[model samples]
Target: MSTSIEELLRFEEERPPDGEAERQGWLRPVLRILAGAVAIVAVALVALRTVGLQVSIPVLAAGALAVLGVRRVTAALSPPPPPAGGGRIGGGEEEGLYNWGARDALNAAVKRWETPLDWSASRPERFASTVLPRLAELADERLRQRHGTTRESDPARARELLGERLTAFLDNPPRRPPSPRDLAVIVAELEKI
Candidate 1:
């Protein structure tokens, strides 16, 4: 006897979403602040009791609010991660793409920063200062030896190498700088040599 086709197709359990990770950006911090405030208030209440001051319910509430406010302010001031699926080479695998993969990783890492390389500095400078300099220094000292014996060198090649990928980065080139991820990808590609 054999099972019907429909029965065979039945799944024992539902599958998870395919790596569609919703970056816990705003919401996660908000929740953390809330939790911290509650904890601080609980401590403050105990402290007030020890000091013999009548723990006013309103005062306790205000303390809780203060903690939340402080936390929110901190979170807002902190930086955010790079956009999702920005530098991914393959479907979802972040490894084995070699230089491409490394570039993808570098771009991803740099993006998780607050102040990035000043795009206004020009492509060459941005590359020289951020990506090229570092990779050239790392992989081999003489690869671009004429450019610079050390890591610091012109960023033009990096920018040029980026080509189309630099569209979003160099478009403004001033206020909005290229994220760390962009520089990283460029560096990774350069390093693979």
Candidate 2:
């Protein structure tokens, strides 16, 4: 019982709208407007206060906070740079292959290489291609160390090493650096490895 073209069009029009689409459509503009309003109000208040007007201290403090907030929000929206190196640090593709040139300093070198990359302010691609690999390797090593060398046998361990957050990031790389919280979480996980 297919409807006629006119009826179909009417039915389509009567259908409930997509809530997610509506929210997404308004999100960006709303944020921009809010940011603009904050900046404008802050500037205006600060300017008025500078002109010998008896502006309240609280007003000045609010303006300063607004300006700082706006700046931080804007900076957070900026893009990240590209990654370098073959994405490998100390533990290259051949983890078991590479022999430490020095004997006593091997642990030190591993420790140095294990140092987590700062994703809080690093490029997304750079984090994935460079920093992520090293962290993944660390996770892998930790897994290996814990339950013996069975990377193929241990799916759960591999997932843990990949990390829920890191897996999402790597699966769909961000256009900008990760948030400070995300970076910290990933770094902490890698350090544990």
Candidate 3:
């Protein structure tokens, strides 16, 4: 009984009457401005009185009212909100169909890694500074997922699990980045972890 009552009250907010916004377009912003201005005046007057200051309340009110007016004007210039009936993305049926996943961000991440890797191939120090850290993180993540211990926590066991070549590669900063074939082999080993 209580669940049904709760569900009934959980309905979406009742939208404004159709054509009401068109008929009284200026009413909402005007009311907001009046309310903000009154609030500012009241606060300024009370604060001045409390501090025993004789600052002109009208001046304070005017400044605040101007700021509020600017805000309203800027908001009016900006893009309006989406349409009433749940917009395109908020369909009652399929959820993921309308949603645009972060395709650009995913592409950007690939480029971010690719750029560093490319740079490291020519400049060995770039491997230490940029690429090696990412590789180490991948290794640590795999180790943690498979063995429940990071390299820092169990270095001896981590070396055993990662094997001598891979462990040595990770332990010291390389004088030069590995060839693409070598890097592919290293990646395959990491995946096996």
Candidate 4:
């Protein structure tokens, strides 16, 4: 089943009540930091006992300072947690149907080709209107860039370079999309031009 863009954007998950997540407060983090600092000081004091009390005391102080510095740096670098409310997760503009992600936009464009191809098979005029002009313009541009002349400027030479199939395709787009092999041949001829 096809999914609507609105459905995809809406948050469907169940969330806790507001203020529940924040109620734990800063007490946990402060206690954790203190415990870590004490542990570091204890380890340093034990490790450097043979160096005498003077050196050991200084080492313990340095260890405590290093632990606190690292904790502070990590806290500063990390992003704040999302608010307790069931608000948007990302701290950016809300994405709408038109503001598609890169992959989604590409997929939508690619999928859209099938509709035109189906129309072309039933109505040649539709193909002529939608696809022929673009192809002709591309051919003209390529010819002009390579030979310093457009298809209209030198029709005879352009016809020879573009080949009969592409020339016919541009003159009149097919009722149905060309096969993969035919397309490859057309592309090869266009590259030669």
Candidate 5:
């Protein structure tokens, strides 16, 4: 059997009956506060019995006040939360709700580019398998768009147009990470192609 779109989109929460919900709205907080008060009072009474009542009561009160003071001071010292949708440092501006995957991918790419030595050392297979294929594809796409042929279709002409550095890198990517200047030159040559 099939379900209607309306059924799928409908709110699925199992809400309590109106009367029960209203009863619980006030009841839960009241019960919680009452329980906490009972616990505090029990502790206070134990202190009073252990020491003399006057000394114990004042000491308990002072302890409670100190806790409150420390909490307030800590709260004041702590930094406020970032405004919603505010991007983090070195990251791009936040996109609405479900863009975390895109942001994460972008951040990972940036990190990979930022540390070429580590990336090449740690993931040498990715360098040859992933990066080379992508660069080759880009070069082929440019050649096809501008000259009506790809590297495979017309290697001699494509290599001349693509230039020595880019052609060599695409044909056989180096085992060591290329310097930023070398990469930039290759990218510039690809754009020219």
Candidate 6:
């Protein structure tokens, strides 16, 4: 016999009925209901006495029994309590749903570029020393992967693939690095390879 992939991946949860919980403690509910009814009757009697009306003790006892009966009926009609293990803050993901402290979620490659890019923004030497070599390596890797040759290995085809502007930019590093917009354009062109 063969099982379908959907059937293999499907998850089913089976839980037994919770009728035992209601039967577990009969005394607690009776006492709690009795206490609540007594408190309610005491308050009602106090209110009636303050307003200059006298209610007999037997009438108050009857009223407490009525309250207890109503409470029992309502408890029977109300929904059962929820499953034992829910109502959590997170969506039950790994670790936690929130990062309470100072958490920076940057990709590894992008994070690696941050320091060099920051330094390069102020100084041409920093651009040459820090950021330029990484860009060159990335360009060369893409060229090699797609065309079987790096920029150094085949300058002619590299220049052809890299447009005139990109080729020129790579060949001669500017005294001052290009603006972020121009650098982004260069990176976009490199990605096309």
Best candidate according to lDDT: 3
Across 1-193, the per-residue lDDT of candidate 2 in tens digits comes to 8779887667434556599877878897668766766676677777887897777656665776677677766565443322355344566536664433423344554556665543445456666677666655766676688757434567666666666765566445567766778778877765665
- Per-residue alpha-carbon lDDT of candidate 4 for residues 1-193, written as tens digits (9 for 90 to 100): 9999999999887876467556656667778777877887777777667575545566576779786978786665564453466245443344532222323433555578766575334665665676667678889999888878777898888888788888888876666766657767777777777
Q: In model 3, what are the clashing residue pairs, if there are any? A: none
User: What local lDDT score does residue 93 receive in model 5, on the 0 to 100 scale?
Assistant: 42
TM-score, candidate number 2 = 0.29
Residue range 84-152, candidate 3, lDDT tens digits: 785565563266544344234445556877874564467777777777889999999999999999999
At residue 69, candidate 3 shows an lDDT of 83
Name the 10 consecutive residues with the lowest summed lDDT in model 6: 98-107
lDDT of 3: 0.80
For model 4, the superposed segments whose C-alpha errors exceed 4 Å read 1-125
Residue pairs with backbone overlap in model 2: 83-126
Q: Estimate each model's TM-score.
A: 0.26, 0.29, 0.40, 0.36, 0.38, 0.40
Model 5 weakest 10-residue run by lDDT:
94-103
lDDT ranking, best first = 3, 6, 5, 4, 2, 1
How much is 87 displaced in model 1, in angstroms? Answer: 26
Can you rank all candidates by TM-score, best first?
A: 3, 6, 5, 4, 2, 1
Candidate 1, residue 149: CA error in Å? 78
Pairs clashing within candidate 1: 103-185, 107-181, 110-180, 111-181, 120-173, 124-155, 124-156, 128-155, 133-151
lDDT per residue (tens digit) for residues 1-193 in model 6: 9999999999989665477865656867778877887887889899999999999977987888897888776665564443467444554436566333323334344676675557555787888887788888988998888888888899999999888988888889888988988898988988888
* Model 5 lDDT tens row, 27-85: 98667655655566568878777886654555555666566556655655564455577
Question: Of the pair 4 and 6, which is ahead by lDDT?
Answer: 6
Which parts of model 6 have CA positions greater than 4 angstroms off?
A: 1-117
RMSD in Å for all candidates = 18.5, 26.1, 21.3, 19.3, 22.8, 24.7
Clashes of each: 9, 1, 0, 0, 0, 0
